[model samples]
Target: MSIMDASGLPATTPDSNQYSAIPTTPSFPPPSRRVSYVASPSLTSLASQLPSNLGRSRQVHDLVRALGLLQDEEQEGQGGRDGDEGRASSPPRATILPPLKVGRKEIGRFHDLDYVDALLSPKTVVSPTNSPTSSPSSSSQSSSDDEEESDSSSSPKRKRFKPDPTPTSNLSRKLLSLQKFGLLDDSPPFPSLAPYVLALAGAALRAAQSVKDGTSDVALCWDGGRHHGRREAASGFCYINDAVLVILSLLQQRISIPNPPLSDPQEEDDRPEKTRKPRILYLDFDVHHGDGVANAFLSPLSLPHPTSSTTTSTSSKPLPGTPQVVTLSIHHHAVGFFPSSSLSSLTAIDTPHPHTLSLPLQVGASASSLKRVWEDCVEKVRESWKPDWVVVCCGVDGMAGDGKGVWNLGASEEEGELGWCVRKVVDWKGGIRGKVLLGGGGYNHPNAARAFANFTSIALGRPPLDPRTPIPEEGIADEDWESFAPSFDLEVPVGNMRDLNSSDYLDDVCQTFAVLAERIRTI
Candidate 1:
């Protein structure tokens, strides 16, 4: 059914275009890669961050690893290759699905790729001397003369990326590629997620390749979820819109991002290439509407693509796909409940700034309601769009039994139907590139985290294991367990929020998009 082959990719080809403005970077000394999770008393036991909500989001990096979503090595080889049967002998994919090779130039490629270039050109290299000491490449203290030269070149260097192809036959390779990018440093709040999103985007492109190879079935791609971000502002603890970027990237690559999927193929493009961009069914299970992602796909009535600089040629061209990425969100909103930020977020909705968001008024529905809503908003897209790929953004907040969920998803003592709903949609038989990605988080709850872990297994067409809550040295005490049992369901009201009024601050942003969830399920 599957096979494993060991062949390195061809030497970096000459066609490797230079997206970054900076010239060949001298390998500078690396900076500290230490990531510290400074937990305050209010957020002590990462699990308790979100009340009946889900688990700590950061836990996903670890849990998925334990569950094998983020393995360093590939496994479960098909009879011969890593993916579905019959993969062509394409060159080994670039080891880094990472965002086009991040450097000063590639980091800021936004609505305007060229503008990003201006920022990253060697002439604009800014001094890292005062940059957020997150992760810095090594450049020692140069003499005063050198400092001046550095300053002359230092004008807030824009980060540039390289164009890399990915292999659709291999999922682990995709994951590894995704993680490598996850480690890069982008501008402010860009956090370490830029590379991750770039890698995920590259991975999505890889999966779409299957459509042409004639061996792929579905496309499943995902990336880190960074909700709480405003257009140009990374909020909700997410620095990069990895989930959205991956989908957009696939579409740009002309990977035929599936709009919505039908049980069978319908209209075929008689043009060159294939439809592997995946009929992307974006499902944001996170409590939020995934505003940044929403903005990327469809600009709200009020918001649209702003006048972008010419440098961003990537943005000018729709890559290679059109309407390839379709998105859907299931989260809590105060439709008519209060002050409407949806309308406010509209002022510049036409402008691309990440604040693009959509919300639902009420989320207190039970399983049936949730399922009906999901299908209404999403399933129909597949029928209409007929996307070749599917990307699922699994947010644990909506999982029943978690605290951050706006609705019970399952009341009357039920375990919740979120996972079941996901399974029902993803379990379609023998689809190529079928995949689900984990995203978003509130108060870190391991249960929510575990639910995500389970979803990854299910997305892979495997059953999930009941996750066990790890205990302390003496084992979790019965009394402690009982005390830890969540009693109330905490929900954020959808309307009259700060994000709507423009008078709002970051802490209350959750209401803007219900914790921003984006899930892409490719069929």
Candidate 2:
């Protein structure tokens, strides 16, 4: 397949043998694995301009470029020849892909059509009926009254009403529509709304496509993991459900593999290879629970009890009717969290949908806490499910110093850090063929940039940058330079918050999942 750059034109392939001077550590999926990155100027510009994430996309793009990850082989060679001191050791070059153009049909796959229309249609009106006191007619009448009163007084000047650009009739209807679609406060419509939705959704779709087509073993779309988007409404600053759409797209394809070795040697020999639906694992590591995604795939069937003989399958094949998609969201949960959903609690395991799982961490969860959860719960589930595709939502909001987060996670390469978790997923061996890494919630713009840049290095099998690495000024604008003040480095060091996930809490988690793992094996 041909590679395209940000300009949408065909880009020349870089020489495969050229290597950078930067040293790299031996990690999972060696440097030879093909990794494709989905991005473009249009995507970043539109995404960064959003009110909630102002300048964040631009920050992430600039940092990744400053790190030299986006440089072509020719650029790297030229930099080395010129003795450019700022360039870091280059890892395997990732092919750049412009965001695809997603239309109403693609978006309608996950969102309600009427809601999509309200978002895309320029003529849609916002109704004034909801606020009668502020209606144009009332404002005009009020202005006339003011003018009459002023004329009677000593002041000769009269107040006049300024007309709205849109007609009152149309504006009122649009307002109502916006409210219906949940686009008023946090997710209000912006000037670049249409393009932002199209670009972000398209970026995610293209990433998933690259993996499904086997053009890339791993795909990265940093602008894509908007998990809180609902089927008919927007929530938690997420206007599009890109993660859900990606999972839906992947479920259509099928793959065949030999069954895993059975405990009984005779039974293993008798089993035959079978063709079945591709199983997808949607693993969310966002600070906030992925309620939209979990709700999307919540099935009606309950998990079979561990002691029930009827729940056990006689053969290695999936139970007669098991779901193809499984969602596991590890997030923070509290009584008054942003999203108040029963599904976000640990009690979800007791519900009917065993495939939809939630692992809620207490406040101030540190790397050690996450490491325990990974080793005990996540790994056990992976072994039992043996998923074909793993979609990871790498949200950095849980990292220390985030305004919205209380957890103390870091982005370094240490054993329980964010990079370590990503490395583990990239190297997974149980029938896994492709991986998709997506971006989610991160309020601290600079740290968000730092975390993703670090992840890109890990994804390319390159050496992890020192947390103290200086922030290069190459791509950042003069006006935005002050945002990186104080530290001016790429470090997101752990804070002083005490990790509340005690050993007892972790032990309970392990015991609970130990039984759930057995049930998954039978299914």
Candidate 3:
């Protein structure tokens, strides 16, 4: 069955032959506003080894391929368009690129050398004398471990082994070291942990490089977005904080703009070079707050500048005192949210880190609530900061049907839905030069695959797949078909959860962010 292209032309149908080998990474020319997907067999295989998201990487990849979203640019005419009809030009068909492994030096940029060494080492051993009496498993089992493991196994090159529940002597000491690094409870050291870290981290780095080098305007790395990883320790099933790494990489690339018209023509002779460090906006849409990323960039110096202070800017450009990077996380924050950091709370006017903002919502937030947040908070901050690059942690755990999620967010194309929010960022105008989309927490594997595949379609300048679209039987294994269950379609339907965000609460959110946005403009 063939589908109609956006130009009302007959488009290619999904055929068995379409599943050819992904092309090799090429020397990308100048930016064409194309979309590039970072993936490799090894990368996906290694990512599947993650205990928290076993086989999820491969599942997302397969669904994308099944949808024919990865077709070569040469195969289809660049006729499809997004947003306004007058926007005749559309991005070229999305391409797949192989990733380069992240080096130890790159990993050390944000993490301590000692922590980096322990993470990359094949085996970290401490003296038996320093051994602790308790083993790592003595703590409560991670919520992720409750999910049934997929029938699919890890890479053939690596052997999988569970951590020793009852350690003795030297092994006990090793467990103690792991605990110190926050790799014990929810995130345990598994076989080939080093390779997994390198692969997933490399994919995210490659996505950032593609955007920075003008290879693509938007880059997607479904295997990336480990936002819970920390500088010295791992948390929330994240071993490497790829989101932080991506931000740091983009921060180094300065933005070049022509000098604004001089307020006084007489001062033109004394004008300096018109360049400023690139500004990055890290927008996270996970169910849980992005504590790792917010903590990584936390700075007491991010407070708003005095009104009279004019250090450099004589024009309407951002003040030199403004932070180079700003992060805003929208998540469900209750009394005992998994990450109970002070940074996860709502942004106060006099907060030490004004640029590090959080918009916490109550249980059962729906599309309408998200719409309010987007219009009042997200867009307001984006306009004020005028970010050069946007790094989005698109965690689908907030979508309905997630065991751990409290929000009633859906993956439909309707206004205020998850897909709609993503499209808004993709189609953002003004100073946004590029975008990077990374995967995060999503427990239900089938639903995660469905949501990500839809997101990939949006990035490819195609309309979102109909929620009722049937799951293709071509490449799916017989035994895995049952995973889709009753409604084996693309839809992630909204549940019956009650939206507790009252108008008074939402009004307060808007009023609070209004003050913060003005403060950002002054900075």
Candidate 4:
């Protein structure tokens, strides 16, 4: 069977080795404000800032740099003081970040104060000062607070709160803090990883703010889709649920002040009052379910009303945060999948909630099956909620040969899906136009990079790369790029995993979506 592009046209594979370098692309072009790339300077600067000594992936870093996605200093240059001519000439090496208050506010919107504080309070042992002398000089700091990681048994006991055994209580603060920030081997808190998570989240929030403010129409968070995290606990290597925060931040359209009893309390100052929440359609194309984001907006804390079969009377008042963002997840589903219970339950129901739509394709789902799912989902949402903003968790694990995925969608199909989704959002009839694309679980690092790069091409309205075109293994990066030279070659064939889904199963899915569509119209 011939592979189809997002536009329903035949996609011809190009020479694999030829990298399409956009020579005319400005360092940071003004027209590209249509799509913003949300990357934190800390991605490189804080490579060694992990308490466990674990850092950002060197492969992702090399691929990104090789693709010329890095923003130049001139684009982020700082203004000098009144009469300092010398300072004006000396450009700062750091990328100016959005305010900490803003990020805290956004995180607080989706997560409880206690959980947010738990993440923020942990201190990483590694700092820029402690960075190896041979490492490049960077502006990334270890932690905002100077409090170093310490053991109370050996060091002076810090001020302690009166005991309250509940996890939310102030008493649990110290223990939770220790669990998260302490040694990595113990309890798997991996508190040291919190900074990187926050950095990705903060960058996304900034991008969302910029979009809301009309500064940009599209935002790309290449490293910020840890979809499996829950409000209370981290799972699947995700500590803080950045995707949830991004949605909440965009919906609220303002930063909320963080006021917590679990840690050093901050004075509450409401600068940006909550605006009318936008109708959001969040699409998760990852192989695994985006349980964190799906549960966040669909839960009673956000959406109290369930999807109704009949329309509500006009006189009834809507619930707080009512008509919550509609989340659609299309992923491989089976009894053995990770975090299987809740997600699998969605498929069991004849009619699931409109807010939490799940298309759990059977294992070994093919490109054609995915396309059908996408078409049905897009049609249902368009006829029902008609979202004002689109957020996509663009994970490529479904690609053949993924470490964690079993489906067989290749680069062409993946790119096609993203391209189609973005184009639809951009062409929505209403004035509403915004999209935030996030990277999720793609374990095959090189393929992940290639997929992301191809998506970037689509986002920029550039021609799609020929799938056959080989990526030159040499001249990409130094030693790190060379190590993966074999994976970089264009000759690797993508296996076609045939669709194992039966016609009866597909009919049931269609019926479920139809029921969901009718249910959402009631809201």
lDDT of each: 0.37, 0.76, 0.76, 0.56
Clashes of each: 127, 15, 0, 8
lDDT of 1: 0.37
- What TM-score, computed on C-alpha atoms, does each candidate reach? 0.47, 0.81, 0.80, 0.68
Can you tell me which runs of candidate 3 are displaced by over 4 Å?
Answer: 1-32, 72-92, 124-168, 259-273, 302-321
Error of 3 at 154 (Å): 30
On a 0 to 100 scale, what is the lDDT of residue 359 in model 3? 96
Q: Which structure is stronger by lDDT: 1 or 2? A: 2
- Clashing residue pairs in candidate 3 are none
Q: In TM-score terms, which candidate is top?
A: 2
lDDT of residue 314 for candidate 3: 50
lDDT for model 2 comes to 0.76
lDDT of 1 at 153: 62
